[model samples]
Target: MNNNSNLFLCKATRNTYEHRRSSLLCQVCGDRNARNCFGSVSCAPCKMFFRRNLDFDLVINKCIYDGNCEMHENSRHACRYCRFKKCLTVGMKKELTRPPRLNQKKRIGKQITPPLIRRLDLLNSNRSKLSFDQWSILSNVTHVYDQISPLPKILNSLSQSSFPPKKRLRIDGATLADMLGLIYRSIYSFLERIPDFTMMSIHDRNLLIERNLHNVGSTSGLLILRDGDLYSNYAFCRANLNTYGSDNFEGVSKLLNRLDMDRVAVKLFVVVLAFSTCFDVVRPSNMTNNIQLSKSTNRLHFNTINMFHIQNKYIDMLFIYMVYRYGYIEASLRFAALLFTALQLCVHTMEAANIQEHGDMLDTIIADTTRKLNVEDDPVV
Candidate 1:
């Protein structure tokens, strides 16, 4: 066979394998066909098994086979402990499982509560409006952001340094590269903590990172500047100043100063940016250099639909939380401002990347961080 034929066959084989791995076989047992259950692709048996054994920790730990039992449709029943462990390992969420529905016949007249009583119940329920799952997502995203953010470390280092508070810290190409590297790594770490992101195929995850990390990093940079108060101390050195010019720095400062500075809102926006398909207001003349646009070859392999779904969740959460915290009119204005700021940041980031050194630095940072993430975890099947 010619090279083209071989390549075609290889691609076909890989796609088939991926489809089977993701949609056909049970994620836990790898034997029966699967369906979406409790936030994972699992067979009915595994779904029932997990629902029955809500205390998964207690059940899985009492393993007779030392937690290493090989599970399949036939052998899954042989070891309940390992089977349940596999279910959890494959991203099955207990919280996603619904409680058994009450018999409608038994509760037919229960809905006829007094109007006053119903009003009181509604008023009380409205006191804490967010659902458990929404709260969980909000808490998880913010906690992950806090854990991976470099601001605290940067602040500590600044406090311990002997440099004068008013004196500017010179940021050369190398220093700038290092700062971006830390930001990229933190963004990568933050994304890894998200279940939906982690559940994607390795190809999809890497593609998202390659195309969107820098744009996301721009938003992240604002958080760092706002949180660390780095605007006063950090300044680009003469070489970088000439390369990026003063206007870019001023733009960043202006955006930072104008931002409303809601930590939760910013964190959720970062998540939204990470999954964004394109950041450009206009198509770039050189698509190859634009981190905002996915390459054609990569676009063919990318799970755009899945990414949109994931992005929508965070976007919804962001808006809902903003409305809950700030009133509707204020939330609407803040959201518009946040998006405008993001666009300005993207323009600045693209301009910076047009410089050879800045572009290379971003590429290196992304490659290094991608390698680390791939090494640390196997892609979810």
Candidate 2:
């Protein structure tokens, strides 16, 4: 019994081997395994079942028996729905079926050449020269700065019915700090837009910014006030007066009244503030140095030659515009007034810095300018 059984097993193994298919049982229906069809190993009956009813109707050909119908080779054809489901359960990929190829002829459109773009060497070509305008460069630079700077939305003046006399803003230390921070940040934005400002050495840039940043903010505030853009006692934004307590509002109101500068005057003042190069624009005392040389000329001996050049360009543009707008005498008076306002701004900045609450904000302005210049703890000259 043992010998016959061993001989029969050996013969069956040889037959399965000669058939060029795995002797392992089929994964789908537990029948004799064949070559892989799609992605899974299954017998011939399951493979044919899958291909024939690849898109079989599950509802119409529903299994009368439980979904677990016997899917062996002999019984696979009895339920096309269950057989296909078993094929998928065994990991057969339906997407392996290839789509039919179309035999339509391709039509090509007529070839047309693209128009040639002429390249001119701007460095050598006279055709690339910029035409001179009285204030085009200055105007363009200021316009770009104005576009990026954070100024308040222009609202109608306090006299306009739009600004109803609402209750005065509640002033807190936090609100005061925020207002001052906004002003300094706006000035920093304007400074960044100056041509060659970032390109200058970090030391020169920081010095130039620290020297004149206060005046820039002041000039912006003055411009807003002079243009009647402030509502009630607030500077451009209503938050401007939220920093000033009831006690300080009177002083602020008086200051705003004195800022009667025209648009041209305000622009010239902004240009002046942008170009200030003196390291100590906000001096402790009335300095004779500013009176004698002017800030730009004073910085000539230092490594701020690049800064001086850029500043001089703006200064020259301002002077030319002033002369064009007004005769020399009137221009001189306007220039003097703007210069005085810069000095006044320095005083105002100093007073604000001396306030206990503003001390941290002043430090923040220095830290921010240092970070913007990409300088380390100590910048090299």
Candidate 3:
């Protein structure tokens, strides 16, 4: 047969295989075929669909049922919006996305600043070239974040909320919602206090805070999990699930199982997250026809160039720190593992936000907090 006929037959064969495999049912659809995509179990077609369309900000179909469409293997394609929501609902982790090409720098060559160029030089320089100020800044950022939102306090809260291993666990949805807000607020407040962050425009500052809040929360959540609370799976601090009417025990358990609990590596990873520029506003995809690179977007992009260098510099410092603490091979492995964790955290945070019943309410809280901060010139505490 010709190429088109052969391709049709191949697809038909795969569909038959999918129908025969009951054990591989997709979570997004009831298809008897599934493949692991991101962090969730999904069928190959669903996985490919999600891979191509994960960014919600991009223009897409509005669910006719208003995001309440029924999904089954045959009907899953009926509503793209509801289907994507289901993808997140079933815990498909976005961080599981294959790393994008490292050619973003090439797209923004004209936007690169002189300061950023110098920082890149410093980043490429030998470990021996590191100066005292670099260490001081890195140390200070870590210290201040810890001091502002003490991990011990979060761990202590988890311990307080949790019951004995054998006891039945009850999670208050309201409390979970409140805790999520608290964590986001703490992290946003911390981000604002990053040295020279205040120098940026208010719009850009808020944009950055909103964009990176999930990552910051994920880092905080992982840190809390790294403590002894993983066994309990009751995250009252970062990603709280309400066990009142539903079961999240298995999901939370799986999440904790996925975390890499290296304290030093995680600390450096948190610094990396603080400087993440992976937001739709910052890095709109080439496939995102709906998103326009307006003048404001370009301006924000330029502003973030400095921020990117700052993050890159810290990342370099992390590489050096890891190399110093562990041998080269181990450090490389740890860094890779940490990067995966960071990616997982990004996906986890998004899923967590959707799973929580109070997700939109929490966004409202952040919005109000942003307005308050913007209106009042009080220093971020």
Please give the TM-score that candidate 2 achieves against the real structure: 0.49
TM-score rank, highest first? 1, 3, 2
The best candidate in terms of TM-score: 1
How many clashes in each structure? 0, 0, 0
Question: Which sections of candidate 1 miss by over 4 Å?
Answer: 1-128, 156-171, 234-243, 280-301, 373-381
Q: Model 3: number of clashes?
A: 0
Q: lDDT values of the candidates?
A: 0.71, 0.57, 0.61
96-215, model 2: which lDDT tens digit per residue? 643333212211222343332444223123322323753566566668655754433222121123332232222345754665566567776766665566566665666666566665
- As a TM-score, model 3 comes out at 0.53
Candidate number achieving the greatest lDDT relative to the actual structure: 1
lDDT of 2: 0.57
Per residue, candidate 1 scores C-alpha lDDT tens digits across 1-381 of 699999999999999987875568788988656888998888887888898777546532454434576676655654455677788889998878755554564476577644455445543444356678989999998988988888655444433234442332343566655665677668888888899888998777767777788788878878886665455332433433656788887787788877767988998898888888775332322345545444655544667788889889888788878877875557789999999889878888878777787777777767777677677676567
Instruction: Give the better candidate number (2 or 3) by lDDT.
Output: 3
TM-score, per-candidate, Cα-based: 0.58, 0.49, 0.53
Task: Please give the distance, in angstroms, between residue 100's alpha carbon in candidate 1 and its true position after superposition.
Answer: 59
Error of 3 at 120 (Å): 21
What stretches of model 3 exceed 4 Å from their correct place? 1-130, 150-169, 228-260, 279-302, 376-381
Residue-level lDDT of model 3, residues 138-251, one tens digit each, is 678777766776444444444342344222133356655555556667776666677656776676666666666666665666665544233333233223433322234444
